[model samples]
Target: MCGIVGAIAERNVTGILVEGLKRLEYRGYDSSGIAVLDSGAIHRVRRVGRVAAMEEAALAENTNGQLGIGHTRWATHGGVTEPNAHPHVSGELIAVVHNGIIENHDHKRDELKGQGYAFTSQTDTEVIAHLVHRHYVQDQDLFAAVQRAVKELEGAYAIAVIARDNPDLLVVARMGCPLLIGVGEGENFVASDVSAVLSSTRRVMYLEEGDVARITRESVQVFDGTGAAVERKLHLSDVSLASLELGPYSHFMQKEIHEQPRALSDTIEQILAQGFGASLFDGDASILQGVKSVQIIACGTSFYAGSVARYWVESLTGLPCAVEIASEYRYREAVASPDNLIVTISQSGETLDTMEALKYAKSLGQNRTLSICNVRESALPRFSAAVFYTKAGAEIGVASTKAFTTQLVALFALTVTLAKLNGRLTPEAEAGYLDALRHLPGSVQHALNLEPQIKAWSDRFAAKDHALFLGRGVHYPIAMEGALKLKEITYIHAEAYPAGELKHGPLALVDENMPVVVIAPNDALLEKVKSNMQEVRARGGEIFVFADLDSHFHDSEGVHVIRTPRHVGILSPIVHAVPVQLLAYHTALSRGTDVDKPRNLAKSVTVE
Candidate 1:
């Protein structure tokens, strides 16, 4: 995914474009550029690095224009070079910036080639500029030319077009991608997300699918696919620019890791205050009453949260639950029923695979859709019938920390509510669960206090090239999440397996060189996992166990134990996640890798 920002204002907009791009750096940062139309000509600057480099280049040129478009590219179509950077200009007349892929760009490129249009860069975005310029010559209207050009393109894209002839008008469109319009006094803005314009305006209009907008200094006109003028609701964004700051933490990842307690408390506070059972499905009781089963669709860290939710949902509600990877589920045939609830989980709520999976499930006559996400304005929330919005303000880290834990908290609240609705949980048990939920924040803070001990163990993890994590029952998903966090941030090779499955295959690769991480919560499977630990010890494997203080495991020569406070019964997964997050962060810091912006990974996956 790439970030696009366009500004049509009365004053100079070079600084505004640069600042907006900086706010969107979490989406993409492979390369960046800006295009400003000044004196009926496009002034462009491109760089092959972060937004800082592009800002420097733009400052060196001293470009000033009232209408402009900027992009921070993720580089899907070409390598990350100056030529591949965005703000592609055509024949000194038109400039364009785009996000998402143009699936039929090769065909369009050949046609433009035969029409005597020479290309300078190998980017799908470059073709849009030429296509618009070709149409602008015939129509002489920037809005109409952009509409005609977009009609010929295929696949997902959110594009903004600026022309030298129409220096005051900016045309932007979206299809199967996200774009929003910002409302201001004497200016208007369009960006991939609302965060880019939060400083200037809190009022925004979220453009729908297949919608196009023509924006000028004082007006914005939106049109639907049928060329009819459409009206969109202007909603106020609750996200504050103060949430984007680092505060005291050195990295966004660290700041987010410490924000888990507040995030989790905020996510479930209202539900717990009313009642997890009746208030959770307050107006939607009929939907839950008719639900025969549940299918959770998610990707990446959200997928691991779904796996944990699956265990809780089945165990509590006595209903069958299945967790499917969204990317795989959307491609294959599936069987679904009207009585099944399709739940999708995502941090950004714009994950392409997860959104497609929900649509695929809907196509199979499953209309009971529920989204557990952090953003209220994302595509998934708008598409779903019901939503549970986690209040994890803004997560900028490439590897998710607070979002995952807050999702678990919301899912756990849902699990308890469903259990009570199905007559599987008693009132006394519900009250006990609620009381524990109230205490969850304190327990999470205690876990964060274990940072010093985790940092010591990170030194050993940094020296190893590979790691193996083991767990049993609900904690198995936590192990998988831990391994994923380590691999994603530190670039270490890591794998996780159910503790019982170790004897089936994975034990053969264990030795002194491999670090075996065990998530040994003192649950029903504690003894079985302990035996698995002994199996690893028999093979001289270095054991690093994050166990409960009462699990009876003591530190020896090779068995290093970091006893987390006695784990909460059903909420143990949320408690155990803290140390896993710290281990990943400290290990990445030790390896000298980019902790906040991991290589080749963007915070949001908005395109297929």
Candidate 2:
């Protein structure tokens, strides 16, 4: 996912454009560029580095314009080079900043070559500039021109077009990728995320697929591809400026890893405070009653969350459930038995592959889908039959830590609701589970306090070449998430192995230089994970274990034990995930990688 922003502001405003790019940098950071419209022309500058570096370059070059579009690119079509950078200009006719891919570019490029249009950049995006210019030549209507150009193309794209001829008007459109129009006092804004414009203005409009926006300094209007004006309202978000602050942490990963306790507090706050979970869960149970089968679809960390949730759903509700990787699941044709339910999970709720998979499942006409998401206006909730919102406020980390933990908490609520509906859970068992779920916020707070110790351990292992994380049962997802967190920020090669599989191929990698992290919280699989830990320890691999306080793990030599609360079954991953997040955060901090905006990673993957 690439970050994009377009502003037709009131003053000479390259400064505001850079500010927008900084806010949107969480989307992508391979390269940054901005093109400002000044004196009836486009003044453009781009560089391969952080947004700050690009900002310095822009200042040095003294580029100025009242209106322009900026982009922080994650390369898809071409290499990470200036040519592949966005803010692509076509002969002073049109400059386009694009996110998502135009799949038919190869054929379109060939066709353009026959028309004597030479290409400068090796990107699918350059074709759009030419196409827009061609349409503008014929229709001479900027809105209709971009519309005609998009109609001729194929595949997913969200584009903002600035034409030299029509300097006052900006054309923005989206197909599968997300686009938002931010309403401000004398000007307007366009960005891939609400975060980019949140500080600028609170009132924002979400542009859905097939919606085209024509923006000016005074007014903004949205139209469909057929030139029909579409109606949408400005939605005020609860996110505040403080949520975007780094807040005395070395990295957003660390800040968010520590925020798990509070994040859980926010997520579970209302239901717990008002004693209203019965109503929410009661309604959920009625809606989900008699479902014969369940399918959970997600991607990346969300996928791992669903994978762990499968155990909770089946164990509690006795519902046969399948967890599928959303990207792969979308392409394959499958039949769903009637009344079967598909549950889609996403932190941003705009995950491209997950959205596609949900849509594909809906097309089968045999299953109803529910979206478990964090953001309210995100695409998943709009398309799904129902939505369960996870109220973890503005997660800015590219590799999710708090969001992952809180998602499990939300899924636990859903699982318990299903069990209650099916009469699978006894009153005693249900009461115990409910009480355990309520205690989880404090339990997570206790686990978060172990971060200092984990960070200390991170220092010793930062220089290590690789790491292996191991666990069993539900803890396995915690292990996978831990490894993913390490790889995301530290740039270290790490792998997660089911503790039982240690005697298999992964055990061969255990060595003095390797650090092995084990999730050995008190559970049925704790001893099994301990046995795997011993195998690694015997092979001279360094061991870091997060063990329950009651366990005799304190006597274990050669393995460092970070004591945590005793948790059983599905809830163990909640406490165990904190130390792993801390471990990755400190490792990345020690090595000096940009933790918040890790290289080649984005907070949202809007484009497939």
Candidate 3:
């Protein structure tokens, strides 16, 4: 949940480092700092807030250098104070910036303290600096010192280290976290994400787990855990800096919500043009031949997406599908089978728990694996046997929007493909599904047209402290996603339940001050959801219904209705998702919360 950027260049890198941190602001951070190797010493400027303030301080101090490292830290081991900010220094010799948790920091800190190493900050990252300094004192070699120090670390981390004594070199390592080297002429860079270095280089090499590298202005050398020299392929990234910009939108969340139409269109058009087959995923159709069931694992928004897919997979393919939250699944005992297709969903594709769960599943002899993700080069896709890439394109908002919709589109395609392979789908049925898929973008755009109304409804929610979301069957997960979005950005306490389950216990929480959001698509459960809406009304709960146009919901004193376009059956979830996202966006706006970077949340959850 942190950002790291390092640069070794012929020119001054202070501005470059600051720009990189700015690009990484979407990842979310409490404090930011930069350590530049100038002349014979390392100079660091750290601030306990945004990059702008740190940059201002750096500019005032004339912080400039040919080699430097920067960090935007989301606190894990310590408080969000300047003393705990990254670019943590050790004895004025070593400077380190790290992402991910160092699990054994306590023991290491105790040992180092016994050896006269003074700890300045209550951070695990500070241990790395001291550890490197301890080794550097012995060999007087920065690279060797870092290599030796990392061997003792026990948990996930991606770190970039620079020594004041070795200004010409930068050392980096990755284990269970993402780290990549940006390939540039007469320069090179390292970042936890490609977005950080996109301005200076389009080509990058991603370091694998347990890999360490030494970078200089001219070249890079990578070594595996065993210390053998290795080669990592350089990839030409397709991400554009313009796409990461907010443009005319006030916040990235709002822009992403509005971009769903284009995002869904791009994702669907690619599969349509390719004519979905084995080519749509990693392996050929042969991989699906023996898959009789599906097991999906994911975390956060991706988990909600998986919950939606469970309904699609079972109904369309006649497969017994199960969805589990990655964090819970990884730590518990479970039954694993080779016939169960291990499907993992994530936007960043580097979600720590999901990745660990996949590894755990594979270790249990579940060889059949598939990853549905947005980034093609992320660890999940690279490690899985098959992958379906979602072309949502650089989702910078901490609370996902386009990424969630695009993932649903991908999962729907996957379900149809599996159904065809299992002989469960007739050609006529496939054609109907494809037609519905093609019209999804237009339907979502029509849903977007309801934003003015949704924004008006948000004014009512601005004063709300609690919300309840209701849906039935497949739309139930959509309700969960809606509740999640509201709480994520607006900080309003929200919960979701199947409409049938409202009377079980949630009904007691409903009152006049409570706003209940109902997803009432014109599907088989429409009548049931309407009944549930009435139940809420009986309890004096304020109801906001996002219904299909043909549902014929009327606006009453206690019931406010916002109609979406005509329902497209299987694709209704994608269309319904648009309004709820807008509701959360506008509600967050009304409450004056940071819609893009919500407090204590990072776009990518790289740590457990």
Candidate 4:
């Protein structure tokens, strides 16, 4: 993932660009840089570290300009070095900041080198700058030059370009990645995310695929790929700056962990207010009428959320369901049918693999597609026929907490809606499920109340280098998510398995030094999971059990029990997720790791 910001303003925009990069720090980057056009020349500064370091250097050098672009790079094409940072310049004529990968960069670089264009960095983005410069020399128009340059390039990319000769304009384009324009009175801005420009403007225009835009201080002109001018609807963004701020909590992860109650309540209440029909999604309930089977595709935390939905859809509607990782699903030759509802889940709708997977399914005639996403303006919602937006506002943490739980709430709603449409859910059962959904916020609050006890176990967990998470049935995916959170934040090697699968192979790794975390809810599979716990105990494995209040589990030597709130049956996974997130947070804290921005990971994976 990467962040891009560009601005053309009446006043000096150096501070604006730096502040915008700071707002995007949550995306995770290894280096940062900025380029500004000042008096018919391009001034550039790049640093191979945090934005703070680049900002300090920019301020010390008094780098100020009325037109500029900035970038925070997550290092895909090249290693972390100053020369590899963004705002890559070519012949002092063009400077570019890009968000996505350029697949044909190597070939493009070879061709550009043949033309006698010197290269300074080993980045796919540097090729963009050189290509733009090559075209600019012929047309002498920044907008037209960028348009001509992109025609030769291939891959997912959102780029912002600035020219030394054309100081009054900035050109931006988007293909598979996301790019938006922020509108102001005497200023215009472009960014990969709304948060980066939230302070300067609340109104924005999101560019569609293959659309290129010429932005100036006074006006914005958007043109499609065919050199024809077009209009893009401007939206008044509802995201407040306060939602992005860390108020009482020490970290964004901690704040997001506690914000789950409100997030679930808002998502559920919005649906309840809408009266829970097909109208809850983008297309009405008729989209579900012909759906015979469900195929869910996603990546990372969203994939696990889809995995949980697999259990719900199969049990509730008797519809066979399958969940696949988006990256793998996009490449494999899978069967697609019109009756198979293709569902894609993503916290940010711009996840490249998931977006491509949805497109691949649509290309194969699986047109009954739906997207569950957090950002209403993201690409997935716009591409899919139906969409359900999760109300987990502004998840800043790289390891998702509120976003994942809110996704579960949204997926559950989708499942029940499908069940009702298929006549599988009786009115009584629907009412009961609705009641449980209404009480979910309170149950999540009860789960958060156990944080102190979870924190008490963090020191011990931090001392260990490996952990094993176990659960049964629906909670098995929850165990996988827990293990993912732990390893993602704490840098511990962790693995998860269905409690019953322990004897297949993983039981051989159990010992006194291994900490086995169990999800022990008092469901139908509780006895089986308990039997699995005894197997770990028989191997002298140190067991840490997060049990339901009525699970009949007690603490003993080598077997530690921390009882969570009463289980809510089908909705237990959402409740059980909070404690695991807290455990990851506390353990990462004890280990002195960055809880919000983990190493080698970006919050939104825009590239493959």
lDDT for residue 371 in candidate 1, whole number 0-100: 87
**Which digits, one per residue and each the tens of the lDDT, describe model 2 over residues 554-603?**
73566788888776445888878877888888888889888888877788
Give each model a TM-score.
Answer: 0.98, 0.96, 0.99, 0.99
Q: lDDT, candidate 4, residue 457?
A: 98
**Which parts of model 4 have CA positions greater than 4 angstroms off?**
none
Q: Which scores better on lDDT, 1 or 3?
A: 3
In terms of lDDT, the poorest run of 10 residues in model 3 is 281-290
Query: How displaced is residue 413 in candidate 2, in Å?
Result: 0.8
Candidate 4 pairs with clashing backbones? 278-285
- Pairs in clash, predicted candidate 2: none
Task: Give a tens-digit lDDT track for model 4, residues 1-608.
Answer: 89999999999999999999988877656999999988779999889889999999998989989999999989898799999999999988889999998999999999999999888888999899999998899969888899999999899899999988888999999999999999999899999899999999999999999999999899999999998999999999999999999999999999999999999998999777765568888754467886899999999999999999999999998999999999999999999788999999999999999999999999998888899999977999998889998899999989999999999988999999888888888888988888899899999999999989999999999999999999999999999999999999999999999999999999999998889999999899999998999999999999999999999999998999999998888999999999999999999999999888899999999899
List residue ranges in candidate 2 displaced over 4 A.
273-286, 555-557
Give the C-alpha lDDT of model 2.
0.84
lDDT of candidates 1 onward, in order: 0.90, 0.84, 0.92, 0.92
Question: Count of backbone clashes for each model?
Answer: 0, 0, 0, 1
Q: Residue by residue across 1-608, what tens digits does model 3's lDDT show?
A: 89999999999999999999999877756999999999799999999888999999999999989999999988898899999999999999899999999999999999999999999899999999999999999979988988899999999999999998888999999999999999999999999899999999999999999999999989999999999999999899999999989899999998898898899999999777876567788654466776889999999889999999999999999999999999999999989888989999999999999999999999999888999999978999988988899889999999999999999998998898898888888888988888898999999999999989999999999999999999999999999999999999999999999999998999999999999999999999888898888899998999999999999889999999999999889989989999999999999999999998889899899999
Candidate 1 lDDT, 1-608, residue by residue in tens: 88999999998999989999999998899999999988778999999889999999888889999999999988798899998899998889899999988999999999999999998888998889999999999968989999899999998889999998887799999987889999999999999888899878999999988899999988999999878999999999999898898989999999999999899889778877788754553224456665789999999999999999999999889889999999999999898889898889999888989998998999998988888889877889888877788888899888999999999988888788778778888989888898888988888898899999999999899998999999898999999999999999999999999999998999999999999999999899999998999999999999999988788889998999988988689999999988899999999999999998888888888877
